[model samples]
Structures are given as C-alpha cells and as structure tokens.
Target chain A: MKDMIMSYSDLSSSIREPWHMLLFILLSSWTLLLCVAPPATWAESDKITIYSYSSETSINNFKLLKMEFDSYLSRFGPYELQPVKKREDFERYTKGRKDCLLLISSWHFGNIGQTYSLKPALVGLRNGKKYQKRILTGRGASANVEDAKTARIASAASDLHTKEALSEIFKGKDVADRADILTVPKDIDALMSVSLGMCQYALTTEGSLEDLKQVNPFLHRSIKVVAEGRKSLLLILAFPESSGKVRENMMKLVKIVQHMPLDPDGRKKIKMFGLDGWQPFDSSDKLTKGD
Target chain B: MKHLKLTWLFCFFLIVSSAFAANRMPKVLLINSDASVSKYGEVQEAFKEDIPHPVVGVNLGDEKWDMPSVENLLYDEYPDITYCIGSKAYHIASKYIGEKDIVFSSVLNWLRLPLTRKTYGVSNELHAEMQIMLFRYIFPDVRKVTMLYSKRYTQELFKNAKDKARNMGVEIAGEAVFKGRNTISAFDRLPADTDAFWLISDPEIISDKKGLSNILKRCEKRNLPFFSYHEAFVKLGAVLILSVDNPTIGRQAAGIAKRVLSGNKPAKNVEPPAGSHIILNMRKVKAYHLKYNENALGSVNSIVE
Candidate 1:
C-alpha cells in the first residue's frame, strides 16, 4: 500500500523505485481491497469495461462473444465486457462510450452506417440461402440432373438465387441449366416439403438445418445440411472510428480475434450470427461495398 | 502372551506380504459399464497378469446401481487404484476418486470427461468417418448411405456420422425404433439406389461382425456395398472403413495410466481420448464385389483380399 501510494502518490512522493515495485504494492492492495470490499466489487466497476454489439441475440453469438471477452480480459486487465442483449442497449453504449465495438448483421449494417458514424472494417461470410433457384433434396428422390428435369428440385425461392449459388458451386456451369431444380420461398417450408414428401428438397441455412432436429427431434431423422454452397459476408464489427481512442479496444479486439481459432464454438457462432471478424479503424475509413 | 506371539507371527506374514508381495500385489479396482468386458477384457487381463499389482474386475450395467457405493466399500476393504473402464463407470468412479489419479478406458466422448479430473480414454478417433468420407470421395457417384439402428440407443453414432457424411455430400438414410422390439422388418424394404450401408455403434443390432454379417448378406443381395464402424463387423461381413480397435484403446488407457502413475493431479490432468485406429478388411470387400480405392487398402489393418 505504501509503495503503490509512493509510485503514483501525490506529487511530492518518491520516484526512485521501479514501477514494477509499485505494481506489486498495487496488486497486494487491490487483492486486500477485493477481499475486504463488498461482493459488488466483482460486478460492473469504474475499471476497464467491454461492450459487445449483439443483433438478434442467440446462444451462438452470446457464447463466442463471451469467450472473446474472457480472452481479452486474460490478456489485458480484468475488465467487464458487458454483453448488451438488445440494440437499444447497444445504442446507449456506443453513444456515451468511445471504447465500445459494435457488431451488426448485414441487413442492419447499412442502416447503422446511414444513421450512425460506425464503420465496417470486418466482413462476415453470409452462408445462408446463397441461391434462389437451388433446392435441397432428400435421399430417396428420383430426379435427373438435366436442367429440364431440375424444376422438381423444391426450395422456398420462386426465383433462382439457389440456382445461381448452386451454379457457382459448379463454377457457373449452372447445375440447374444441366438439371431441373424447383425453388421455394422459405427454408422451413422447403424442409417440410421434403420431409412430408411434398418436394424432394429445401433451401435452408446450414445452422438452421443443423438445429432443425434440435427443435423437432424427429426432424433430424429426415433432414440434414446436404450441400454447402451459399457463402456471404453477413456480419461486420463496426465501431465509430471518428474518435482516436475508438481504436483502443477495437485494436485489442482485433488482436484477440486472430487467436480465437482454438474456440470452435466462437468460430461457429460467428458464422451462425452472420458476422465475420473485428475490424479496428479511425472514423475516416469508409464502410462501403469496396470492402 | 501366547496370543501376542501368534499375532507377531501374523505380523511377520504381513510384513512379507508388504515387502516381497509379488503374488499378493497391490490391488487395482477396474469397473466397467457392461458385463461384456470383452471390449476391454484383454487389457484388463494384461493389467492383472503384467502389472506388479493385483487387479479386481467388476461390472455394472447401464443403470443406476451402487458402483461408487461398492467402490467406497472396496477402497475401505482394500486400498486399490481404480481404472474406470467406460464412460458411465468413469462417472461413477469420479464420485470417489478424490485426490486419487484415475485412468479411463474404452470411452467415446472424451469431451464429456470432467476436464478437471485426471481422465484419459479412447476416442472414436474420426477413423470411421474419415474412411467413409474417403470412400464417398473415391466414389463420388454415391449419393446416399443407409444406417440401421435398433430402436434402442439410436443416438449411437448417427449425429457425428450424419454430419460428416452430409458435409462430404453423401446422404444418410436412417431408420430407428430398435429399443425392445426385435423387428428386423425395417430392413424388409430397402430403398433402391441406396449406395451403401454404414453400420454404427449399435450393440443391440450388431453385437459382433457375424451379427452384422447376416445384415450384410441382406444388403449384398441388394447389390449394396456395406461399411461399418466396428472392425470386427468388417471381418464378419460388412466391408468396413474401421472396426473399433481395442488395442489402440488399450494404448490410450496406458497413456492415462502413465499420467496417473506419474502423479499428475487428476482434476487438472483429464485429457481427450486418443483417436481409434481404423482397421479395414478387404475379404469382405471382395465378397461384395466392390473395388474400393487402393488408398483404403493401405489403411487396412487386416486385408483378406
């Protein structure tokens, strides 16, 4: 306590000892404070704070964010990385704070940019329904691969987004051009179509398809992620770079992101939540399509 | 005084037993989830005969019973090291293995093992999946593979295998309801154009290769290729990508033994089970008149063809 007071003490104190000596003093004092103080000290405090942006919060995004927050705290000091569940809290954190990083979906990202000063420095691959014409099918369906025969391929989209993505998967040869695939409007409808024998297939998000049986245990008996063709940047980590200090947490966050490979749930959640990675920048950088 | 002299003589016997006790060795308690210890039977026999210690084997099936209850009594009756043999047994042993290092064996879900506990076990080792995926890769035309399970324990290897297969662009055809009903009628109608039948870890359906062999005969009659996760299932009839390699499981158990014997704190020392070795047999492949990639032959532990 004396040394810490001496190190950062009032103007008249000593300057001879190493700061590390002061660190130990502060450490012991803080440990003593923690032990002596009320339990609330462990909760939100005046110390470092972390704010993560969540959109349409799900278990996947929540977990990965928590893991990253823990990793950040372990590296830096023990700071509170508070996860705000709704966009309203997110708005509050960013407006009053310069240290917060915001993550939003692609649909909301454009709105965030138009209404707020946040910039997108990272890109998340959007992996759902990459094709409008592509229809996911079941195991025991009889269909030829010719384009004329492909309309039987059923998905939610009446258009050909699924078809285009499937074509891209086959390198623009157009699997639909070569085969007949029917399209649908929604994933659930497509899943039901195939499961109920209405159609042979459905176009759905990988995460959604993977968890279908989780919601309906009997669903997995007849459904699964058959072919992975859709991929896009659906999530971006945006922070108001107008302020110089905005990059402070974002930089550490970027550094933290690079090393999160060991956390599969984090990676999977990042994918499921439609976000790519954290990008640190000054507000001057443009958050645009060129990215 | 006479009784005291007799006690002293008995004390001398105890000293000899404690000192030169080659025959009366330190007892090690091994518990398993099933009476079919054959899965880990060989290793248990090796531990009993090879170790300078005595190993007592006990079995408790997959129901809530007094395993740890018996274990507590055993620890009191005889001071012994407990090597839990299966996943459930390990959990039962966890209740009592405080401050004692524990070795785990023949368990599939290593992730479920308490990371804080000193645990290590055999992993399913992605061998079966890799082999089957490779088979799908070599035979890109194969769109669907069928997996049959007893109504009981359908959760077996379906999810893991299903994900890997689907990701590899192969379709999975699954049918269940094997719990207590012995209706093989599910296979009465095999879907045509089904390329292969992948056997998974359903002991109720296929206890051994021969049991799977009868199923393979049915599959073969339909001109369908057969593959299995269990190695012996391949030897029986299903041309397999892997048979559960118990020896690799033994080595994994030994690895845990090394950790336990070395006195690493059990709570902090539990690690994932080492992966299993895929043993592909070709005689079964030849019987089915199918040509697997030559690469699969290289990975086969025993190939009859």
Candidate 2:
C-alpha cells in the first residue's frame, strides 16, 4: 500500500525521461490543436454562394424563397442561396467573393453595382415590364411632397434607401433627412400603415398600389399618390467581373437564372421573387441610375 | 280565398323575421387590460380594422372603473361576444360575462384559463410544436435542449413540448424548480450534451430581471445558445426569440369572433396564434459561435446586430 502511490517528486522524475517528455509535448500539442481548430462541419467549402437581397419581398418569405430557389438551383451544381436582410450585409458578403452571384434589386444594384464590378446579366420582368415606378402616397388629398416633412412615412425600403428614394422624389427639399420613416416588411404593409392611420404617408411601388387597388379597393381609395419617382429597373441577377474558374461558375449561374422560367419548379421559385420571368439585360435599355 | 291570403302573409312574416335575425351583426365589446400598454392599443386597432362590427372598448386599468362599474357596464351593453386583450381583462370578462361567447388574446399560459365551449383564444405563446420546428429549422444541429421551469406553471407545457420535440427528432430535458427557489442552480444540473437552453415563460422560474440576467450570464459562461419566448431578451443576448405578432393575434381573435357571431362553430375552440414574429440576435449567435441556418434569415422579423 505504501508503494502503490507515487509522490509528486517521483511523478515529476518519471516524466523526465526523454520519450516521456516527447510524448507529453505531443499530447499537449494535439490538445491545443483540438482546442483551436474549428469543427469539421464548419470548414470552408468550394460551393458557390448566391446572396439574395430584395426590398420588395418581405423578410418572412425569405426562408421559403431560399428553399424553393435552392431546390431548383441544386440541379445546376453546388449552389447555395443565402438571403440577406440588410442591404449593407448583402454588399459586405459579395464585396470580395468573386465565386459568388448576387440576386439584388436594381435600385440596390444601381447604388453599388459599379463599385462591386457586378455586370448585370439578366433583368427580372414582373407583369412583362422591365421597369417599375415608386410612388409616395398619402391619405385623403394630402399629396404634396412638403407634407412628408411633418408626416410619418412608411416604406418597405431600408431606412437608408428610403431616404435616398425620397430625396430623388422630393428633389431639392431637405425633407428626406427630417422625415420620420417607418420601415415595414412589405410594400403592402407600408400602404396598410397609411390606411390604418399608423402612418400618414407610404413610399411604395406603383405596382404595389395597383395590387392593393385590386385586392382591397376600400383601403386603396383612401390613399392618393403624392409623388412618383423615375422608372427604375426591377431585380437583376448580376455576376462579378472576373476571369478563370470564378467567371465560368458565375456564367453557369446566369444560364440557370435565365432558364429558370422554363421549368415548372423553376417558374414557381422565380415567382417567389415577385417576378413573372427573367429577360436578358440590354445595355441600351434606359433605366434610372439610382443615387 | 281570405284564408289562403292569411296563410301566405304568415309565411312571409316568418321568412322576414328569420332573415332579419341572420343579418343582425353581433355586438362586440373589447376589454383591454391597460390602455397605457401600446401592444394592447395595437391589438384594439387591428381588431377594429377587421371586425366588420362596431366595437365598444373599455380599459380595465382606468381609475374611473371598478369591478361593480365594469359589471354594470357589461349588464348594460350586454355584448353578444366579449373580446379580451390580456389576462386581467379575460378574468374580469369571464367572471361577469361567462354566459356569453368570449374570445381572448395576449393571455399568458392560456391553458390555465377557465375555458368553456363558448370560449376561444389566440394563445399568447407559440405552440410547442411550432417552436420546436422553428428551432430545428434555424438550428438543424441542435438536437437537445434543456429548460428550467416551475412544475406548477409549466409541467403540462413541458410534457406537451417534450412529446412534440420527440416527434421532430429532438430531445427536451426539463428540471422542475420549486416556486421562489433559486432556479440558477438548475443550470448546473443540465445534461452535458444540451445543445441549447430554452427559456420558457414561467413566472416562478424567471420571477424578475435579475434572475433572468443571471440565467443568461450562466448560459454565456457555458457557451450555450439561449432561445427565449420574448423579443426583449434578444437585446440581452438571447440567440433566438419567437413571439406572437400582437396585431395578427387581434385579427385572429376577430376571425374567431366573426365565426361565433355568424352562428358558425369554429373548427377548434382554441387555436395557436397564427402569426409568429421571430427575432435573431446576431451578436449572441456570433459570440456563441452557433451553427444557424442562413436560409432561415427570411423568417426573422428583426435582427439585433
């Protein structure tokens, strides 16, 4: 019993042997590696990620949109659809990822497309139109742009983009900075806010207003368009300009999106983005270059 | 010929009376627990929008009203159906107008309410099935979750949630803490394999802000993701929050009210809240280094960076 347990000095002496010391160092290093390494599942892969950012689609629909889109894009290759909620996050994600593609609103593209070197490949067509207009709507007969200064403006656009769009519509009025903006999930919500008396004005697309007119004529009748913005392009599927493998992968994505409307499953997925189909982007087409 | 004409007039009178009864809109009385609470106001506003009937609203928290005054008002209005916003309003309405059909929302642990055949509700919290499914959707790898709850308040909830979670290929482990006991110690007894902590709305377990903060701190120390039932916890480091949309709950209650008023029986007496508002705390997610479904971002109503 006395010899069964080793003393601290004896244990230290036992580890002094050359092989014992080597084994201890090796074990320590292995433990350290295990501590510092990321889990095997989290390791980076070569799958091409497509970042989607659309102000038109409500955040609640992003998951369904991604699932449907992913199911369709799976046939093409190793493609992943990541829906980004914020415009800044979308831009940050696609900033340096040449192996990625972006499905973004043209309003967003016009703002940062040149900076990111994203060449628009296909333009989304909703109701067979390539361009859509933004309208500032208010309750009753209050349609003046100056009314927005004192009124709470409801918009589906991000606060930053809402200000920019409003600045363009208001033109020379510093109302954009002072106007109280309420960011809702969808254009319908923005319009409904005005109808519900939650907000005095709503910044929504002309298409959305028409949609409301069809669905809820009672509410639509209460809202009047105060101002309108120049025709802006719809959604754009753009690829970062790059050479070699990255460019080849991006071109494949372009082909997939262009052919999305042909397949039944593809059409279902494309419609989630609030579009009827996709059209080739012609450089000659006149569209609003967003500020 | 005179007898034939008299018979025809009697038949016409019967048809007209029945038609008038069918066309008569049921009177709806809205009882809000507190007019000062913005959420209650939102619910009332949304209810007004969808009801298609004129609604008389009363604030239970008003200084001018007492139990007897409220009772008198109920007797006077004699609403065909009562809509209650919170638990206090529900209790008062059920106590006074128990005979009439009642529709309630924003009440916590509605299963504890004295529900009857005439009672319908939109649950204040998301159902265990929907919540567990959401957890699976957002965190596919989180197979096991642990919760600390007071048996009195959450035992049935835990049992139901356990059953639903089991069906979804997830395990829910619970530790029953006595009322007024220190619930923080239960965290140490959690299983080693727990992938996340589920914060249920148990008043006995989380009695105050300090207790909630301590639990959250403990979760952070253990590097476990905490999923809460309220959005306020998101800013305090809850990784995910699933809450009922108040306005939608109002609309849902109105829907049920419409059914009851139109003499149509609802498919179910009590239904889960139809609209769920999800909030994701990105800071906590990153801090915990949690694995989350990036595609599930769209389901999130708000993200706290």
Tens digits of per-residue lDDT for model 2 on A6-94?
57457667797899989978988999999986443221444678899886543455666676678777666778789887677787778
> What TM-score does chain A of each model score against the native chain A?
0.43, 0.80
**At residue A206, what lDDT does model 1 achieve?**
56
**Per-residue alpha-carbon lDDT of model 1 for A147-249, expressed as tens digits?**
2234334443323344554564445554555533333223433454455343445555554454344333444565544554533334466666554444664
State the lDDT of candidate 2 residue by residue for B1-305, as single tens digits. 99999999999999999999888877899999997898888778878876879999899879888888899999999999999999999999899889999999888778889888899977787666667766876677888999987878888889988886776678999888787476877777888678899999888988888887888888878888889988778777788998766766676678778778877766678776545677778788788788875545544666666
Most accurate candidate by lDDT:
2
Overall lDDT per candidate, in order of appearance: 0.51, 0.78
Q: Candidate 1's error at A79, in angstroms?
A: 73
lDDT of 1 by residue, B71-134 (tens): 6665674534677777777776776654555667667646567744444444544333444444
